[model samples]
Target chain A: MPVLYGSYRSRATRNLWLAGEIGLELELRQVWQAYRLDKPDAPDAPFNTRSRGFLSLSPMGAIPVLVDGDLVLAESLAINLYLARRYGGDLGPRDEAENALMTQWTLFAATAMEGPGLAIQNVHTYGRADSEAGRGEIADKVEALGRPLRVLEGHLGRDGHMVGGRFTVADINVAEILRYAQSHEPLLAEYPAVDGWLRACQARPAFRAMWDRRAAEPMWL
Target chain B: MPVLYGSYRSRATRNLWLAGEIGLELELRQVWQAYRLDKPDAPDAPFNTRSRGFLSLSPMGAIPVLVDGDLVLAESLAINLYLARRYGGDLGPRDEAENALMTQWTLFAATAMEGPGLAIQNVHTYGRADSEAGRGEIADKVEALGRPLRVLEGHLGRDGHMVGGRFTVADINVAEILRYAQSHEPLLAEYPAVDGWLRACQARPAFRAMWDRRAAEPMWL
Candidate 1:
C-alpha cells in the first residue's frame, strides 16, 4: 500500500478522492501545515509539514506526498496523475496522445487556474470578503481568472469532460482546482457548461466520500 | 514530423532545445503573441495568437502549442514530456516511476518557480530594475523564489541531475524555467548547487543551438 502523508483538509483530499474512485487503499499518515497549527513547534504536536520526517520526504514541505513503493511523489495533482496512470483502469490515459492531452490539461489547471482560484478561495475562507480591500482583491482575481475559465468553459461545452470524452484524472484534477472558486456562485454561473461539468464531477460517489472525510477533518485555517 | 506553433522567441524555444537534444525534427511555424505586435488588429499583421487559425489550435491563445500527429497539446513542458517519451532515448523516463518523478519535477517548476522567475526576469528585461519600485518587486519575487530553489538545490546536490541520476526531460523543463531568473546573478549565487546544475544544463550543445536561434529572433518585450 502507498503511504500518503497529509490530512484530508490539506491537498491530500484530491488524492483520497482519486483513491476512492479506483478503490486503491493508501496508508494515509495525517500531516498538518505548521502555519495552520497554534502550537506547531510543541514537542507533542502532530507530524506536520515542518516536521523533520515530512521535510525529509519533500524539502518543499508540501502536503499530499505519495510514497508508492520506491516512488515518492509530491504535488496533489501530480500524485493523482501518477496514480491514475498507474492504477486507474479507464480512469487513466489509454494511449500516448491521451497521456499528453491529460498532462496538458493538468498543467493548465495548475498554472492557469490554481493561483487565482486559491486567491479567491482565501478571500472567502479567511473572512477577507468582509473587508473592502479583500473584496477588491477577489474582484481582481476573478477578472484575472476569467480568461482561463472561459477557455475551460469552451472546452467543456464539448463532450462535457476535460479529456477522452470521459471522466478521467484530467477532469478530477481540473475540477478540484476550479473548486477553489466554487464559493463564488455568481462567477461560476457565468459559465453554464463549466458549472454543469463541475457539478457532475463533484456528484461522483468518490468525490462525495472524499468531501465527507474532508469536512470531518479539522480545518485550522 | 510534429507541427510546432510559436516562434523561436516564444516558449517554443524550450521545445526546440529538447528537440535538438533528441534529434527530433518538428515543423516549426512562426506565431507571435498579439500583444507583441505593433498593431495587432492590422489585417497585414502576421499570424499570431489572436489569429483564428492559432486560436482554433489552442483557445487559451497560448504560444508553443504542439500538434504531434493528432495530438494538439498546449503547455511547453507537457509537449516536451510527450516528445521525450516518444523519441528521447535516455532523455525520457525509462519506467513508470521515472515518469512520475519527471512529472512531479515539471509541475514543481511550473507552479512553484515559473511565477517568481518570470517576475524577476521581466523586471530585468523591461528595465524595471532601473527604478526603486521595480527593484523592490524583483527583490520580493526573488525571495518568493528562494524556497523552491533551495529544494531544487538540495535535489541537484544528489547526482547532478533531476532523476535517474542522468539528464532527462526533468532537467530540460526545470532548466528552462530557471533560465528566466538567470539574469539575476546575485540571487542565483546564493544556491551554488542550483547555479552549477543550471550552468551544466545550459552548456549542452542542444541548448546552445536553441539559444543561437532565439538570439536571432525579434523581440517585442
Candidate 2:
C-alpha cells in the first residue's frame, strides 16, 4: 500500500484529485488534520512538519510525503507523476514520447502556472487585490501570466485536452493551476479557451468527487 | 538524432550538462545565437521565441524544446529527465522507487530553487544587492531560501549524492540550482555540506565542459 502524507490544505489536494481520477485508494496522512487537535507543537508528535520522524522521512519534512514500501518520496508533483506512471490505467503516457510531454506539462504547471497563480491567490487572500498598489502588482503578474495563458488559450481553444485529445495527468496538472485563478474573476476574461477547458476538465466526475472531499475536510484555522 | 531547441541562454544548459555527463550528442539549435548574427526580426524563423514556428513547437514559446522522434517537449527539466531516462545508461534510475526520487528532486529543483535563485540573480545583475531596499529584499529571499537550502545541507551533509548513494539525474537537477547561489558568497557559508557537495558535483568534467561551451556561445543583446 502506498501512503500519501499531507493535508488537502496544502498542495496535497492536487494528488488527492489525481487519486480520484485514477480510482486509487491512498492511505492519506494529514499532518495538519492531526495538528488541529493533537499536540502539534509537542516534541514527539509526528504531525509536526519539523518532527524528527518526518525529518528522517524527508529532509524538507514538507507534507505530501509518500511512503511506498522502501521508497519515501516528498513533493506533490513527483508523487502525482509516480502514481500516474505506476498505477494510472489510461492516465499514464503510452510511450517515451508521451512521457516527455507529461513531464513537460507537469513542469510547466509547477514552474510557470503555479507561481503566478499563487501570487494572485496571495494577493486576493490578503485583501490586497482591490487596492491600487495591489492592482498594479496584480497587473504585472497577470501580464507575466499572459504568455502562458495565451499558449493555453490557443492550444485548448483548438484541442480538447492537453495531450492526445484525452484526459491525462497533463490535464490534471495544468487545470489545477487555473482553478486557483477562480478568486480573481477578471483574470480569466482574456483566456476564454483556458477558462472553457478548465470548466470541462473540472466537470469530470473524479474532479467533482475530489472537490467534495476537499470541501468536507475540517479546517484547522 | 534528437533535436534540443534552444541555446545555453535558456534552460537547455541543464540538458546539455546531462548530455555531457552521459556522453550523448544532441543537435543543438541555437535560435537566439542566429538572432544576433542573421535575421533578428525573422517572422518564420524557429530562432525567434515568438516566431510562428517556435510557437508551433511550444504554445508558450519557451525555449529548450526537445524534439525526439515524434515527441516535442518544452520544459528544460522535462527534457533532462527524458534524456536521462531514455539514454542515461548508468546516470538514470535503477528502479521504480528511484524513478520516484528522480521526479521528486527534479520537481524540487524546478519549483523550489529556481524562483528565488532567479530573483537573487536579478538583484545581483541589477547591482541592487548592496542597496538598502535591495538588501532587505535579498534578506527576504535568502530567508525564504533558507528552508530548501537547509534541506539540501542536511541531506548533502549525510549523503554525497541525492539518490542511490551515487550520481544520477537528481544530482544534476539540484546541483544546478545551488550553483546559481555561487554568486552570493555568504549564502553557502552556513551550509558547509551543501557547499562542499556543490563544489564536488560541479568539479565533474561534464559540468566543466558545459561551462566552457556556454562561455563560447555568442550573446545576443
Candidate 3:
C-alpha cells in the first residue's frame, strides 16, 4: 500500500477521495501544516511541514506526499493522476487521447481556477465575508473567475463530463479545485451546467466518504 | 502532423522545443494573444485570442492550443506531456513510475513556480526593474521562489534528470518556466545545481532551434 502523509483536511482529501473511488488502500499518515501548531519545531510536536522528517520526504514542506515504493510524489492533482493511471480501472484514462484530455483538464484546474477559487473559498471559510474588505475581495475574485467558469460550463454542457463522458480522474481533479469555490452559491448558480456537474460529482459515494472523514478532522480554517 | 496554434513567443515554445528534439513536424498556426491588438474584435484584426475562430479552438481564449486529429488540448505543459508520450521516444516516460515522476515535476512547475517566476520575468521584461518599487516586488517574488528552487536543486542534484536519467518532456516543461526568471542572473546564482541544469537544458540544439525562431518574431514585451 502507498503511504500518504498529510491530514484529510488538506489537499490530501483529493487523493483519499480518488482512492475511495478505486477502492485502493493507502497508509494514511497524519501530517499537519506548521502554521496550525503553536510550536512546529517543539520536540513533542506532531509531524508537520516544518518537521525535519517530513522535509526529507518533501523539500517544499507541503502536504500530501505519496510514497509508493521507490517513488515519492507530491501535489494532490499529480498524485491522484498517478494513482488513477497506475491503479484505477474505469476511473483512469482509457487511451492516449483520454490521457491527454484528462491531463488538460487537470492542468486547467490547477492554473486557471485554483488561485481565484481558493481565494473565494477562503473568504467564506475564514468568515471574512462579514467584512467589507472581504466582500470586495470576493467580488473581484468572482469576476476574475467568470471566464474560466464559462469555459467549464461550455465543456460540461457539450461533453457532460471532463472526458470520455465518464467520471474519471479528470473530474476528480477538477471537482476538488472547484469545491473551494462551491461555497459561493450565487457565483456557482450563474453557471447552471457547472453547478449541475459539480453537484453530480460531489454526490458520488466516494466523495461523500472523503468529505465525512475531512469533517471529522479539526477545522483550522 | 499535429496542428499547433500560437506564436513562437508564447508558451507554445515549450511544445515546439520538444517537437524539435523528437523531429516531430507540427503544423504551426500563429495566433497572438488578444492584448497585443488595438481592437481584438475588429473584423480586420489578425487571428488573435479574441478572434472568433481562435476562441472556438480554445474557449479560455488562451494561446497554444494543440489539435492532434480529433483531440483539442490546451495548457502548454499538458500538451507537451501528451506529445511526448505520443511521438517522443526516450524523450517521454519509459514506464509507469517514470510517467508519475514526470507528471509530478510538471505539476510542481505549474503550481509552485510559474506565478512568481512569471511575475519576476515580467518585471525585467517590461523594464519595471528600473523603478524602486519594481525592484522591491522582484525581491519579494525572488524570496517566494527560493524554497521551490531549493527543492528543485535537490532533485536535480540527486537524479541529474527529471526521470529515467535522460532528457524528457519534464525537463523541457520545467526549463521553460525557469527560463522566465533566468534573466535575473544573481537570483539563479544562489542555486548552482538548478543553474547548471537549466544551462544544460537550454544548450541543447533543439532548444536553440526553437529559441532562434522565437527571437525572429516581433518583440511585444
Candidate 4:
C-alpha cells in the first residue's frame, strides 16, 4: 500500500484527485502546513510535514510525499505522474508524443498556473480575500494567469483532453491547478474556454468523489 | 530530427544539454530573450521567443519548443524529460522507482532551485551583483536554496549520479538548475557537497560539448 504524506488541504489534493481517478487506495498521512511552525505544534498532530521524520523522507519539506514500497516521491505533480505510469492505466500517457504533452502541461501547471492560483487561493482563504491587498493579489494572479490560459485556450479542445484525446493524468494535473480560479468568479469569466474545460474536468465522478472527500475530511489542523 | 526552438541563452540550454547527452540531433532554432521586445528588427536577428510564430507553437511564448515528429513541447525541464524517456538510453529512468526519482528532481529543479537561482542570476547579470539589492537577492536565493541543497546533499552521490546509480538526464535536468550558483562564489562554497556534485556532473563531456556549442553561438541580441 502506498502512503501519501500531507493533508488534502495542502497540494496533496492534486495527488488525491489522481488516486481517485486511478482507484488507488492511498494511506493519506495528513500534515500540518508550514505556517504551523510559527505557533506551538501539538505533541503528535497526525504528522507534521515540517518534522524531522517527514523531512528525512522528503527533504524539500513541501508535502504530498508518496511512499510506494521502495520509491519515495516528494512533489505532488511528480507523485501523480509516477502513480499514473506505474499503475499502468488510462491515467498515464499513451505514447512518446502524449508523454511529451504530459510533461509540457504538468510543467505549465507548476510554473504558470500553480504559483499565481495558490496566491489567489491563499489570499482568499486566509489572507485578505477581498481587501485592497487581496484584490491586488487576485488581480496579479489573474494577470499572471492570462498568458497560460490563452495557451490552454489554443490547445485544450483537441478532443476535450490535453493529450491523445479523452482524459489522462495530464487533464487531472492541469485541471487541478486551474481549479483555483473557481473561487474567483471574475477571473473565470475572463477565460471561458478555461472555465468550460475546468468545469468539465471537475464534473467528472472521480473529481466529485475527491472533492466531496476533501470537504468531509478535516485534514488541516 | 527533433527541432528545438529557442537558444542556449534561454532555458533551452536545459534541453540542448539533454540533446547533447542523448546524442540526439536537434535542429537548433536559436531564439532571443523575450525582453528584447523593446528592440528593433535585425532582419535575421535570431527568432525571439516572444515572436508570434513561437507563441503559436508555444502559448506561453517561452522556449525552447521541441518538435519531434508530430509532438511539440515547451517548458525546458519538460522538454528534457520527454526527450529522456522517448529516446531511452541511460538518459531516462530505469524502473518505476527510478522514474519517481526523475520526476522528483525535475520538479525540485523547477519549484525549488530554478526561480531563486534565476532571480539571483538576473540580479547578478543585470541588476547589481554587488549592490544592496544584489546582496539581498543573493541572500534570498541562498536561503531559498538551503532546503533543496540539503536534500541533494543527502540523496546524491549514489555512485556519482542522481538516480539508478549512474548518470541520467535527471542529473542533467537538476545539475543544470543548480549550475546557476556557480557565479555566486560564497553561495557555491557553502554547499560543498552540492558544489562537488554539480562540478562532477558539469565535468562530463556531454555538458562540455553543450557549453562549448553555446559559447560558440551568438544567440543573444
Candidate 5:
C-alpha cells in the first residue's frame, strides 16, 4: 500500500487520479496546514517545517509526495511516471519511440505549461488580480503560454492522444496541468484538438471521480 | 544518425556529451541567433514568432531539439534519456529500480537545478556582475539554490554517484547543470560530496573532450 500525503484540491488530485487508474490501495494523509508567508511560526502552516514525515519525504517541504514503504518519492510528474512504470500496464507506452514521446509531453507540461499555469493560479485562486504587479505578471505569462498551447494543439490535431493512440499517464499528467489553463484562460475555442483531447480525458470515469472528490473539498489557496 | 539543432555550448551540450559516451553520431545544426528578450527580428531567435523550425521542434521556441528522422524530441533531459535508452550499454541502468532512480534525478535536475543555474549563468556570463539588479538576482538565486544543493549533498553523501553508484545519463544530466553552478559560484566549498561528485563527472574522458570543444567555441550570450 502507498500513502499519499496532500489534500485533494491540491496537485495531489493528479496522484489520486493515478491511484484510481492503477487500482492501488492508497491511504490519503491530509496535512491540515496553512501557509502564511509572513508568519513563519503559524501552527496550521501549510508545508509546516515541523512535520517530520513531509520533511523526510520532501526536503523542500512541498506537496504530493508518495510514500511506498521505504521508497519515498516527491515531484508529481516523477510520481506519476513511477506509478505507471511499476504497475506494468497500458498506463505507459510499450514501444521505445512511444515512451520517448510520453516523456516529451510530460516534460513539456512541466517546463512550458507550468509557469503560466502557476501565474494564473496566483491571480485567480490567491486573489492577486488587483495588484499592478500581479496583472503584469499574468499578462506576461499569458503571452508566454500561447505558443506552447498552439504546439499542443498542432500535435493533438493529428493524434487523439498525446503519446499513443490510447490514454496513458502522459495524457493524465499533461491534462491535469491543462486544467489550470482551461479554468483561467477559457480560450479553448481556438484549439479544437486540445479541447477535444481534454474532453476525452475528462470523460474517464476515474478522472470524474477524482474531480468530484476535489470539488467537495474545501478550497485552499 | 540523429540531427541535434543548437550550438554545442548551449543546452545541447548534455546531448553532445551523451552522444560521445554512447558513440553515436549526431549531426549538429548551429542556430547562430542572439536571444533577444523582446525583439521580433533576431535570426534563428527561439521566441521569434516567425521561425517555423523552431516552433516545430519546440513549441515554446527553445533550442536543442533532437530529430531522429520524423520523430522529433525536445527537452534536453528527455532527449538525453531517449538517446541513452536507445543506444544502451552503460548509459541506462540494469534494473527497474535503478531506472526509476535515474528518471527521478533527471527530472530533479530539470525542475530543481536548471532555473537557479540559469540565473547564475546570466549573472556571470551575460548579465554584467556589476549591475545591481544582476548581482541581486544572482544573490537571491544562490540563496534559493541552497536547499537543492543540500539535497544533492545528502544524496552524494550516501552514494558516490547520482544513480546505480556508477555513471549513467542521470549523472550526465545533473553534472551539466552543476557545472554551471561550479563556474559561477566559487563559494561551493561547503558541499563536499556535491563538489566531489562534480569533479568526478568532469574527470570523465568524454566530458573532458566535450569541455575542450566548448572552450574552443566563441562565446554566445
Candidate 6:
C-alpha cells in the first residue's frame, strides 16, 4: 500500500489528487490531525525537526512524504511525478515531448510561483497588517508575483491545460500552487482563461472530494 | 539536432553536462559571445536578464532553457530529469526506491540549499567588503545555511552518495549548487565526505571539459 503522510490542507493535497487521477491505492495518513504546530502533546506532535519519523523520511523536516513499500519520497512535486510515471496511463503523458512540457510547467510552478504564492499566504495568514514594514514587504512580493501569474494567463489563453491538451502531473502541481493565489489575490477577474482553467481543475470530482474533506478545518498559517 | 542556447558559465552548464552524460548530440549556441551584461550593446542589457536565449524561452528571463526540436524546457533540474527519462539510461538510479531517494535529494538541493548558496554567491561576487550592512546580511544567511550543510554532511557520512551508492542526477544537481558554496566558504574543510564527493563529481572527464570551457569565458554577470 502506498502511504501518504501529511495534513489535508498541506501540499499532500497534490499527492492525494494525483493518486485519485492515477487510480492508485493510497492510504492517506494525516500527520497533523492531532497536533497543531502550536500544540505539543498531540499524537501528531512528532512532525517537527525533533521527530524521528520525519527526520528519517525528510532531513529537512517538511511534510507530504510518500511511502510506497520501501520507496520513501519527499518533495510533493517529485512525488507526483514519480507516482504518475510509475502508474503510467492517462495520469502520465503519452510521449516524450508532452512529458518534457509537463516537467517544464511543474518546475515553473515550483521555482517561479511558489516563492511569491507562499509569501501571499505568509503575509495574509501570519504577518501583522498594522506594521508598515511587514505589509510593505509582502505587498512588494505580491506585486512581483503578478508577472508569473500573467505568464500563466498567457499560456492558458494559448492552451486550455498547462501541458498537452489534457491533464497531467503539470496540472496537478501548478493548480495546487495557484489555489493559494485564488484565495489570496482573487485577481481572477483579470484572467478569464486562467479563471476558467482553475474552475475546470477544481470541478474534478477528486479535487472536490479533497476540498470537501478540508472544508471544516480552520485555515492556518 | 538539439541546440542549447546560452553561455557555458551560466546555468546552461547543467544542460551541457546533462548532454554529455546522456551522450546527446548538442550544438552549443553562443548568444553573448562578444558582449557582456555590462556592455552597452549586450542583448540582455536593457532588462539585465541572464541571457537573450534564456529570456526568449522564459519572458521573466532565467537560464538555462533546453530546446529540442519544437519542445523547449526551462529549469535546470527539470531539464535534467526530462533528458534522463527520455534518453533512457541510468543517469539516475534504476531501482524504484533509489529513484525516489534521488528525487528527494534533488528537491532538497533546490529548495533548501539554492537560496543560501546563491546568497553566498551574491556576497562573494557582488558585495563590497567595506559595506558593513551587506557583509552582516551575508554573514547571517551563511550562518543560517549551516543547518542544511550539517544535514548534507550527515547524509554523506552515512551514504557514499546522495541518492544511491553511485552517481545520479541527484548528485549532478546537488554538486552544482555546492560548487557555489566552495569559493565563499571552506566547505570542504568542514565536511570531508562532501569534499570527496564533490571532487569525484568534478573529476569526471565530461565535467572537466565543461569547466574548462566555462573557465575560458569572460565574466558576464
TM-score of chain B of 5: 0.86
Which digits, one per residue and each the tens of the lDDT, describe model 6 over residues B1-221? Answer: 87766677677788788777778888876655333555735554533344454466666455566688788777777777777766737775676676666666777787677777777777777755348976776677668667778788888888878876777777888898777767565545777888888899999988988899889987864
lDDT by residue (tens digit), candidate 2, A1-221: 78987787777887889998888989887676344545766765546576666667776867888888888888887887788889987788888888778888888877877887888888887899889988887788788787778777888889878877888888988888767766678888887888888888889898888788788877664
Model 3 DockQ (Cα-based): 0.84
lDDT for residue A1 in candidate 5, whole number 0-100: 79
For candidate 4, the clash count comes to 0
TM-score for all models, in order of appearance = 0.98, 0.92, 0.97, 0.92, 0.87, 0.87
B-chain TM-score for every candidate: 0.97, 0.92, 0.97, 0.91, 0.86, 0.83
DockQ of 5: 0.53
Q: What's the distance in Å from true for residue B44, model 5? A: 12
lDDT of 3 by residue, B155-195 (tens): 89998887788889999999998888877778888788888
DockQ of predictions, in order shown: 0.86, 0.84, 0.84, 0.75, 0.53, 0.57
Best DockQ among the predictions, by candidate number: 1
TM-score of chain A of 2: 0.90
lDDT of 2 by residue, B16-94 (tens): 9999998898998765634444565666444567666776777666678888887778878888888989999778888
TM-score of chain B of 3: 0.97
* CAPRI quality level assigned to candidate 5 from its DockQ score: medium
What TM-score, to 2 decimals, does candidate 6 have? Answer: 0.87
TM-score (chain B) of candidate 4: 0.91
Q: Per-residue lDDT of A1-221 in model 1, one digit per residue for the tens? A: 99999898878888999999999998999899998889887888889888888898888898989998888899888899899999999999999999998999999889998999899888888888879998899899899889998999899997688889989999999999999988777888789999999999899999999998888887884
Question: What is candidate 3's CAPRI-style docking category based on DockQ?
Answer: high
Scored by CA lDDT, what does every candidate get?
A: 0.90, 0.80, 0.90, 0.78, 0.77, 0.74
- Candidate 5, after superposition: displacement of residue A33 in Å? 6.2
Q: What share of the true interface contacts does candidate 6 keep?
A: 0.62
**Candidate 2 ranges beyond 4 A from true positions:** A33-46, B33-46
Evaluate candidate 2 by giving its C-alpha RMSD to the native, one decimal. 2.7
